[model samples]
Target chain A: MNEIKIFSPATVANVSCGFDVMGFCLDTVGDEMVIRKVDKKGIVITKVEGFDLPLETELNVAGVSAIAMYNAIEVDFGFEIEIYKNIKPGSGIGSSAASAVGSVFGMNELLGRPFNKTQLTEFAIKGEALASKCEHADNLAPALFGGFTLVKSVSPLQVLEIPTPEDLYATIIHPQIEIKTSESRAVLPKEVKLSNAIEQWANLGSLVHALHTSDYDLIKSALKDVIIEPHRSKLIPLFNEAKSSAIDAGALGCGISGSGPSIFSLSKGLDVANNVKANFENVYADLVIDYDIHISKINTKGVKIIG
Target chain B: MNEIKIFSPATVANVSCGFDVMGFCLDTVGDEMVIRKVDKKGIVITKVEGFDLPLETELNVAGVSAIAMYNAIEVDFGFEIEIYKNIKPGSGIGSSAASAVGSVFGMNELLGRPFNKTQLTEFAIKGEALASKCEHADNLAPALFGGFTLVKSVSPLQVLEIPTPEDLYATIIHPQIEIKTSESRAVLPKEVKLSNAIEQWANLGSLVHALHTSDYDLIKSALKDVIIEPHRSKLIPLFNEAKSSAIDAGALGCGISGSGPSIFSLSKGLDVANNVKANFENVYADLVIDYDIHISKINTKGVKIIG
Candidate 1:
């Protein structure tokens, strides 16, 4: 009861039609953190594993997020935390969110679960902001609450965990390359056409409807991102070919995950998810590229205690 | 079996956050049409009622829509159509949609239902174009599909009929004023801030979730219209007061119905709907204005054969 080891799942943000408002949690790849209450007055990083992330307590995403949660509570205590990073930073899948959510979730449990999910998410975003440089919760929400989450409004810190069909699956391909979130975001248009905006909202509506109704064909039709993907795809190598190949292999649709260097596709069955992976492997082979592919069902349980 | 009378309900498009992608049909207010098969090879309007709409076949929205359906069937037959108007044009409701949908629905019945709801909607838009001068299906889709409808893609003609909660009710107030659709549309900004667009999309995503889950509080939060309501409220009389009063009276939310001149509010119960209606009357009384109000649940049956 004095210490705990917790896990936070990886996440995919801006899921095609969702743009800045949507994201989903993944089941396989994530981050692990061990937190124990200390006698000192502030957080400290005892150890870090798997990647060369910052060792300073305030500098790391997990440490920063833990600090936010520590400051929110009235406990005159500190924590020494150990992190095992699995989701690589700049993977465009939620590397930072996994770390941030993992730390906050673990710290909350160590403090006897003082805060609810929404309150914990607020603290988590502070840690995410350290890396993202903006207080956006789209990535952290699903990592915190699990499944498909919508950041309805950041000002009010409103979020909703939407339902997904049991048979749905996700196929993600993360290329062994770095693309800064800043660089990826800089390519998007400042102003979208009104007609295009209408089309985008309609697709978003359909995507949400498809999720509620469990309609696969409707989901396929709803996954085309007309605005951001068209502009940002150029930043990611072989983006078009990978997307087209995935669709050709029966992916519902494909697009850049979060920002760039990684792409994802949705499928209704294991066969389609595997087919999408094979298609991605072929594209990488054709271009002499290196990539890591993960086939996972949508994660229902978010950050949880492992030990 | 040769003659039939069909009624198409009026619709409210752009339900707050949806803009041009969503609409819902009404139960009490609509338009009626009578169609008969004659020994001819084309469609014709033998009689007209109410306002002085164009009598020429191609000029009338109803006539124009009927022609689109008649041409598609290749039945080597014609229709003699009679229009009886009830829904008032320029009410900021889908009056034109009623005419267009009523005619196509009646003629399809005369043609022995050759076209389904989707096909009938396609022909109906051709008639709607004669009125709006643009082939937008936001209004007609609901008139055909009934209940809540989403025009997911205008290009591929993707439309969906969204489910509504059994207890959800709508309160609409039509002020005795005229605001042309052109004039209403002219007020919108050509480009919206990306921040606002993000906020808008989040509201839309929440709205869809609310509809699916039947969460009243979620529906209230999701019903807020930031982009269009602010711009279009200027065209309507006492819009802010009416909206505030409706919300104060326990209505979920209120905003301009389609563009302006007419306003609609959503409530969870009949008592609140009536309370909203009384509040709107108070607003009109304070402004020395005249308005007509209708209170009803979400219409489940759309265009129907009457006689």
Candidate 2:
């Protein structure tokens, strides 16, 4: 049997208004998975590097992803799977999503690429659900398609590719913190004031418009979050100072990436991007700032197999 | 003293999730305001046409718009303002907004067009506030700038022009019923479930993404309103049928235009637009369905003299 290896980029889920439905792949961060077909009747898993990840078929991130695909499609072929964990677990940078999506993408290749992008996304989402208990596609879509992507609907797992301006730059700062997705989900209120909801929608609408037109000023103004950010910011250390420093350093906007701990800043120019990184590093002294900024154009190309 | 003829396009406020902060102008339906400066120091009443409009300044749509503009800029110049209303009042096609925006546009022209589009939008919003008691820019921004415009912020009135797809088409239907904006606003819940709010934001976020990329399918899926439309639909007669017919007739999606009584359908081609218009006309027997099938194009010259 031919050996297949595929690498899936780590993704940023939630993405403000998108919550469980929207996400994008990061070029500089993600995970790698290798799959090889064998005569064994059951799936076997191995984890390499970073964190003591679960290896159980029912409990592990990669194992769940592979099992979901096998059950859904009734694929009886057994395989050995290896996950190269690069994205830090629980950093809120879609660490689990990288593993889940990478499993499906690698498995698909090993199985001769039977499923399309949308189909792969569905299988990956099942893996995500097992890990997060929420049917979210934000991370999976971007992982599969690359760049800045939007998930229109979750039930059918509809994804849309939005145009990202060439001048756009992203600076991500992963503060070393352990905040589980389940914990963050619990902190959110079950009911929200109608006024706050309206403001969130308005800002979200404007953000989309700004992105489409490549209007920096509108993007800057619309990057505000009146609902989730206010509540989640309290969990992150020096969240306000970090956001303020990023904005003051000339970022168009700054916000908590995914759930918490990690933060991303969007800038219009390289100079501003560097400045934002510097400010973020200065504000959070203990923060392990990833100076290797994901400064490429919006990753339009999602997950692809490497020979 | 100068004679000026100005036309302001009818606007669709809210534009789905934007509520008070977003709007766009319709090329086919609008109000025309002809203003002539008079020697008097105070504003004077003039002629009003299209729809049985009231004559009193307080009750008059055009009068309130003029007053809002005058109050904002402290203009003492008196003028005879004739509102040649084309878009019907209380049709949810921005009838009042057309008058309000028209008045500001006309007055600016009568005063040698001093204020810019943003300034005119501010004045129009003030006029809108008088009628709705809430400062919303959705109608004003579109009326003042035309095309798919976004209100990034309300307090400082930040606005941006979103890219309009070349093949974009809009088919609007006026159901001839009176669904007042006040009543529509009254029906909406004071609070929303947190789950619903997140879904709304997710859909809204995707809608913006779809608009930017001209993703027709995504737009169709994202046009849903789980919060406002369900409640407001009960008020408008044949709301569900009109939408169903419109979608069946090849519309990408259909929703209440602004508040209600009018339904707007989006499509990708002219043939679909015509079909959608016919569908609405067939279902609503008692209504005057004006099929304003417009190509999605930005109106750069907003509220100006037609020389």
Best by DockQ: 1
lDDT score for residue B198 of model 1: 68
TM-score of chain A of 2: 0.90
Clash count for candidate 1 is 0
If scored against the real structure, what TM-score would every candidate get?
0.95, 0.87
Write out fnat for all predictions, comma-separated: 0.82, 0.83
Question: Each candidate: how many clashes?
Answer: 0, 8
lDDT of 2 by residue, B22-122 (tens): 56667766677788777775555588877677778767766777776776665555777887887766777777777787777777876777888888877
lDDT of 2: 0.74
Least well predicted 10-residue stretch by lDDT in candidate 2 chain B: B290-299
lDDT of 2 by residue, A111-205 (tens): 77788888988888878888778788878888888766767677877787766677877788877767766678777877888888888777777
